[model samples]
Target: MPRTDKASRLIAAPPARVYAAFVDPDELLAWLPPGDMTGRFDHFDARTGGSYRLTLTYPDAGTGKTTTDSDVVEARFVEVVPGVRVVQAVDFVSDDPAYAGTMIMTWAVAAAESGTRVEIRADNVPDGISAEDHAVGLASSLANLAAHVEN
Candidate 1:
């Protein structure tokens, strides 16, 4: 069976700013990686039908899906609504069958009383990623995002 993971945060920024952080490569590079991972994009295009390839390098050895310390992800922009939402179809570039599948990642931002409410929903998550780990990763990413946009 497929699994879904979700995380949300209230950022002290406007919706447009929060949304831009999601689409901009520089902003994404600053906050997308969770925990001790660092990220760089091989190519990026933020639009419907566009695509991007991102490589995330983990701090620890032998903890990556693609390489010994790296995880490569190829994602296509399935939907892009400015200031509202962005939906991506993501694939992990790995030889292991446990991580070979397309996952849908939906990022939604909405105006709130204090700030923008950002939510991320990941569907059809690969079985190789445990739920607890994914939850921590998602929360970490959200916290990073909040820090990036709030400051």
Candidate 2:
């Protein structure tokens, strides 16, 4: 059976600003990596039917899906709604069967009293990624996003 994971956060920024951070390559690089992982994009085309390739490197060695210290993600933009939502079809670049599949990642933002409420839902998550770890990673990414846009 497939699994789904979700996380949400209240950011101290307007919806447009928060949404911009999601599509801009530089801004995405600043906040998308969870914890100590750092990300760099091989290519980024933020539009419906477009795609991006991102490589995330872990702080520790030998803890990566694609390589010894990195995870390579190949993702396509399934939907892009300005100031509202962005959906991505993601795949992990790995030989492990447990990590082989398309995962749908939906990022939605809405207006709130203080700022914007951002939510992320990942469906059909790979079996190799533990639920607890994914939750933490999602939350961490949200925190990073908040810090990036709230400042």
Candidate 3:
């Protein structure tokens, strides 16, 4: 069984704007990242049973340059709560061999005094994936999301 790592972020944007990021492919393309990588959604249905694919491009970290061309990763929505929550399972296509199986990610959005509080509860992490790494990634991605919505 995979342990779950929960992460929360506060965004200055309202729940609606923050929620829009998950449903709007265009918004997703603008924010999903690790600084060195970015992605574009090929197709996103954003509803339960909906399947989607995103093409990710990673820049060479060593040289801080773009290295790999866009590559695809696919996912399917398991649940959805409009402007509030989403649960999905995602997997990557890897040649590195260490990466395998799908991971489940749940995104919950709540209205707050400042704006929106976004919580991510991720589970089914593959063997090679570390909790620390997931936390960092989720935090960074949330930061990116906050910035995106703020802009």
How well does candidate 3 score on lDDT at residue 54?
78
For 1-151, candidate 3 gives per-residue lDDT tens digits of 4677898988999999899898888888777775667777778898999989877776653321122454467899999989889999988666544456788989989999998999998787766567787788788889889989985
TM-score of 3: 0.86
Off by over 4 Å in 2: none
Model 3: lDDT of residue 148: 90
Superposed model 1: Cα runs more than 4 Å off: none
Off by over 4 Å in 3: 61-71, 95-97
User: Judged by lDDT against the true structure, how good is candidate 3?
Assistant: 0.79
Kindly list the per-residue Cα lDDT of model 2 for residues 1-151, writing each as its tens digit.
6999999999999999999999999999999999999999999999999999999999999989999999999999999998899999999999989999999999999999999999999999999999999999999999999999997
Q: Over the full model, what C-alpha lDDT does candidate 2 score relative to the true structure? A: 0.96
Candidate 1 lDDT over residue span 1-151, tens digit each: 6899999998999999999999999999999999989999999999999999999999898999999999999999999999899999999999999998999999999999999999999999999999999999999999999999996
TM-scores, each model vs. reference: 0.98, 0.99, 0.86
